[model samples]
Target: MHPPRANRAYRNVARVLRPVLYAITRRDWRGTEHLPVGSGFIAAGNHMTNVDPITFAHYLYDNGVAPKILAKSSLFSVPVLGWVLRTSGQIPVHRNTSQAGDSLRAAEQALAAGECVAVFPEGTLTRDPDLWPMVAKTGVARLALTTRVPVVPIAQWGPQLLLGRYAKVFKPIPPKRVTVVAGPPVDLADLYGRPLDAATLREATARVMAAITALLADVRGETPPERPYDMRRGGGGAGADGPAAPTADGAA
Candidate 1:
């Protein structure tokens, strides 16, 4: 019962991927009731492996929603893949150029048009040695505040079994079971209507990350790290060129 307004290209792509999706993985999605009824919301989740994006899209589609992603702009440079992205109404993000806000504007347009937008706040995969969530960027924060839409914090596990951040291995002999759980919409009412300053955005981003981390902890039945991984300072976090930096499929 997915919303019927999804672009024809999106539906076509889904039909093509449905068979392959079932071949390599099993899905366990909770918090189905938390999904917004119609549209105009963001689904923000942790980044672990490249496979999670499609699987997460599967999750959303199965729950009667279509996913429009904020993908890297470089992906739009490809011939065939880029065509699919454009036809499906997916947004491209310019991570390097001064025009990065273009991606946000595109996303805001999608949200306003009643499209369900998905984003990964951790600009890259977690460099955490233990694969826990690390510090995240404020893109999701900016999106939510600007549109005043619900930011649903989601957690997904087991995609790493099929493909991990640093590990290029793909072991699908038995078909791994991936668990995705969505928590309630993050509350940013107090932060709303205020100036979109770094401090406010940081606070909103922390709340979004905390909610996702808590759901992830529930999925793993373990406690998360006290601090998020910091890749820039070269602390205990894994290096960007570390195991998870190779491909951009599950890219930020």
Candidate 2:
């Protein structure tokens, strides 16, 4: 069953914190009603700024759902933040091979328990100068297929403008207008009986990314540049230095 008590508490905290976060960031959310009311689903979004997750969590909390994000394991190393995150039951993801299985297992257990989880399919922040979303990783698709959970695509804008890429050092710019938009959940029941092969997984993932891109376009009211977001000539050259690359249609 869903963690109703925990979710309720999360919502209460969100109601109190969102206003404060908005006061600092000046965020404006739209289309949040598109999110479903309960658990057993995955809410996925584009990863741009580091603050994107917090923005999403706060919004979800305001809308009556406490979202548990799949954060990088390294974040758990922080002193106080780590303690709060662990006690709150946030999922820790190990991107490296050594702990990937353990992370996946943890996610599976969470899903089986009827909890809602958020994932940034892009894996990491976009390094492209324009900040268009890059190709997404397949982990989200694999998780959805494994757990048979519906996937909800969310589009967020404005956080990058306030925090920019240097939010770590610089104070966040104030009174920035941030927008959060949620799309209808993408159903994968059609593939229930089919083999979960690479092609199928990619197809599903692409659809999810497309939904997010469309929502982003709506919020920005402009078409994104068509060039690849990752412009590095070779792989690994796109180390966290530049803006994120543009994604091919459904390339994520």
lDDT string for model 2 (1-252, tens) is 222536544544555555767676765767777766655678888877766767777666666666677877766675544554565667776554466566567767777777777788777786656666665666777788888887888888887775565466434555667788888888777866778776777666677777888888888888865543653442222212211111111111
What's the lDDT for all of these models? 0.76, 0.66
Using all chains and alpha carbons, the TM-scores for the candidates as numbered come to 0.87, 0.80
- List of clashing residue pairs for candidate 1: 165-244, 166-243, 166-244
User: Which ranges of candidate 2 are over 4 A from the true structure?
Assistant: 1-19, 78-84, 227-252
lDDT at residue 119 of model 1 (Cα atoms): 84
How far does residue 185 in candidate 1 sit from its true spot (Å)?
A: 0.3
lDDT of 2 at 76: 64
Q: Best-fitting candidate, measured by lDDT?
A: 1
Q: How far is candidate 2 from the true structure (C-alpha RMSD, Å)?
A: 5.9
| 1-252 per-residue lDDT for model 1 (tens digits) | 435866677888777776777888887889999999876889988888766667777788888888787877776666655765677677776665676567777778888988888888776677777777776776678778889999998898998888767675668768889899999999999999799887787788889888999999999999988777876664434222211111123333
TM value for model 2: 0.80
